[model samples]
Target: MRVMVASLAAVLLASPALAADPVQGRWITEEKDAVITIAPCGAKLCGRLSKFLVAPPQGIDQRDVNNKDASKRSRKLLGMPVLTGFVENGDEWRGTIYDPKSGKTYRSILQRKGSNQLTVKGCLGPFCQTQTWRKAG
Candidate 1:
């Protein structure tokens, strides 16, 4: 029926630009300390800390004591969302990245380089730090 055809078309047409986003995957941080997985979340893409390669000083079962929000301080860091509110912007995705160590949030931009590397930039106004993340194995 036309209704069935329209529904199928709606789903297909709704799936646009982001369907082939190469940056949507797991990546190892520059320090090789953790693995973050990037995936679609709502209207934008978000990355979450999926695994810890090295245990924190507080051990593997660490709580987010450094979190600025008192209510969230007791939360666990594993599976915590590090990158959020990211939306496609040309060759890069701009968003916010949270540093669990510092308990601060910074503006972040992400771009994929080649097939195995991703450039992550965290910015504080005019100054920015860059790190290259490798594809997670």
Candidate 2:
């Protein structure tokens, strides 16, 4: 009885950790426009822009001049933190996402669509937009 009870307690305690899938790696957007890399940040998971497959065309304005420090920055938007504090929910993840293009952050959710595909959703209340991402090679 003692061994059985101990084993049950151990399993219960480790359940959370065991349920979490390792999502640390690089993912690319379906359009091949952006790449995101996920890694551990403290006890939570965070993701940042790792690469840009194509640069904004010349004469195209891509700066958000509305943010507090927007005027102090350049047009470069690479390496920005797009996802943060995402907690795993089965095969999906929920958290906050920052969009450099709009200089805004929104509630976000990410799901593994398949072995090499991911779907990311950013929402504000009922309005939501989803984007597909592929595992980076």
Candidate 3:
């Protein structure tokens, strides 16, 4: 009886640690255009731009800019943080996403849709857009 009780206690204690840190890896957007690697940043999680499968899509223009600074034109946004301040919530994580193209930040949430898929949503009040991301090898 004592051995059974101790074994059960150990299992219960280990469950949370085994829950899996879903965001602890690299994820690629469904478009397969870019990949972001997420890892522990202090006590929170942060995502850094890992790769650009190709040049930024044509016809896409920068949104917020003074249009006068020469240095801005030379900025390399490939390794910028697209996700930050994310806290684990069950199978999902909630945080803020910065869009370097627009120079804007939005409230974002990421939820695991599968073993290797995540649904990312960025919103301003009631308006929102969702994109699917897959775990990258």
Q: Using TM-score as the measure, which candidate wins?
A: 1
- Which structure among the candidates has the greatest lDDT? 1
Quote model 3's TM-score. 0.70
Tens digit of per-residue lDDT, candidate 3, span 2-106: 999999999998787524347668998767877889888999998987788756754223222422455564545567677999998765788998776566678
Model 3, residue 13: what's the lDDT?
A: 89
C-alpha-based local distance difference test score of model 1 = 0.92
Give the poorly placed runs of model 1, Cα more than 4 Å off.
1-21
CA shift of 58, model 2, Å: 7.3
RMSD in Å for all candidates = 7.6, 4.2, 5.0
lDDT of each: 0.92, 0.77, 0.76
lDDT of 2 by residue, 13-128 (tens): 97865344466789997679878998878888899877777765532344434344756346445665779999887667888988765677899988876678778899999999
lDDT pick, better of 2 and 3 = 2
The local lDDT score (0 to 100) that residue 39 gets in candidate 3 is: 85
lDDT (Cα) of model 2: 0.77
- Rank by lDDT (best first): 1, 2, 3
